[model samples]
Target: MAHPQPRTETSSDAALIRAWQAGDEQAAAELVARHARPLARFLAGAGAPDADVDDLVQETFIRAFRGVDRFRGHCQFRTWLLTIGGNVLKDFGRRAARRKVMPLDESVRDVTGDPHEHAEASEVEALLAAGLKQLPRLQREVFLLRAQQGLEYAEIAAALATTPGAARVHYHHAVRRLKEIVE
Candidate 1:
């Protein structure tokens, strides 16, 4: 490999991956450090609870590093990482679904403060959460990727393994439903 360029926030992920492949551990750390925030945001927006987002982010990177050989240059690295994260959360949801539901006060409550106790923005956020939960999984994921993460439809399509046209349709449906619910 050519002289490794200085690692910075702006360094291309492909370059970081190449250095990592060449045995530079720091390159891997830089990759995680650079993208972890965005990955966490995506996870949170995709319906991961506050308590679980950190673990999900770590697992996403672990899977990515272990499966690096399989990563084709089909999408941006962050997009790929988000895809891994969505899978992790899906698996977690599946396991949780198998367990019996517990009453909110008995089984568990969100560690984040009371969902009901809040001002205007908080109320709006709560409403949005309820609306999001009602969306079909694909529509919810598409909406979050496009609206919250600011990804283009092509990137969202790549991450979600759908066509760009389908992704666009999902986004429109999600927006219509959320508007009906939130407003």
Candidate 2:
């Protein structure tokens, strides 16, 4: 009878990639588990509808796994995964544009006329969501990736297939516009 080799633990994502390439299914599962939540957060924060996020996230992993052999390890796995997420978002956006479905206005109403309370907060959130929708796609993506996902500019650049400098510029413009809308 043949015995399976024990899996080695390592901090390097490259190690995980090697293990995965060697047909260790656990390595693939670990990679997906590690990146899944952050990817979902990125999709949600980037304005994907609540109902579609899970589907999009699943699609991202499906695409990633299908192309796992082509992942050359030129970038960190997180960066690469986020790049895949961005591409998924782009595809979603294209489909949304074609469908021409306008997202519902998210204004939350309060029955009570309390001047300083939950209603104000809900109103602000609604306004912020609306303002975010007004931003150009690149700017909205950069802002959400940085602010919501806590991605550094370099990672944002990689995800967007742009330079870090451009990512910084987009973030700056997005912040400025959002501030104007809120204030």
Candidate 3:
């Protein structure tokens, strides 16, 4: 009996992109599987209210697929996807800011815990979210991309449409501001 060899997972993103373009649906799935959680984390940590995180992640993938032809491999695929995600977040924030009727999510208090502990944790989280909201969008994105997403300065720069040097500066400023916030 002949047995098939197991496939290796060493394919570069470029190769995966090519495969996806050639109608190999698994390649798209692989890309999404590899990146989706990180995108969600980045979105959440970058000031996306928790309720909107999943939708924003889905929208980022949708936009990336639709605009894949414009991707020139000038940077890593994850970097390009973060750029798309960042744009989506910016647009969402703008629309949200314009709409004064937006209602806050009422489900958070449903969790089981000592009310005082939960309230304290919620207050701290709200303060951190507010601090992130106060940062210039670039600094916030750079900080989350580097600190939370574990991207290198060059990758963060590419994702945020800036120089690596500028990314470093943004990260420093963000850290200082966030420390001021938490302290």
Among these predictions, the greatest TM-score belongs to 1
Cα-based lDDT at residue 70, candidate 1: 82
lDDT of 1 by residue, 40-105 (tens): 988877777777788889999999998998888888998888888888988877776788542132
Clashes of 1: 0
Counting clashing residue pairs in each candidate, in order, gives 0, 0, 0
Residue 65, candidate 2: C-alpha displacement in angstroms: 2.0
- Badly placed stretches (over 4 Å) of model 1 are 101-118
> Which pairs of residues collide in model 1?
none
Clashing pairs in 3: none
Which digits, one per residue and each the tens of the lDDT, describe model 2 over residues 1-183? 966556555546777777787887888888877888988877766667766888998899888877878787655677677668878988998898899975544443224555567567767876777788789888987888788878898877766679999999999999999999988
Give the whole-model CA lDDT for all candidates, comma-separated: 0.83, 0.78, 0.82
Q: TM-score ranking from best to worst?
A: 1, 3, 2
61-92, model 3: which lDDT tens digit per residue? 98998889999887789888987898999888
Q: What range of 10 consecutive residues in model 1 has the weakest lDDT sum?
A: 102-111
- Which of 1 and 3 is the better model by TM-score? 1
Ranking by lDDT: 1, 3, 2
Instruction: Please list all clashing residue pairs in model 2, or write none if there are none.
Output: none
- Report RMSD (Å) for each prediction in the order shown: 3.4, 4.4, 3.8
> Which is superior by TM-score, 1 or 2?
1
Residue-level lDDT for 151 in candidate 3: 85
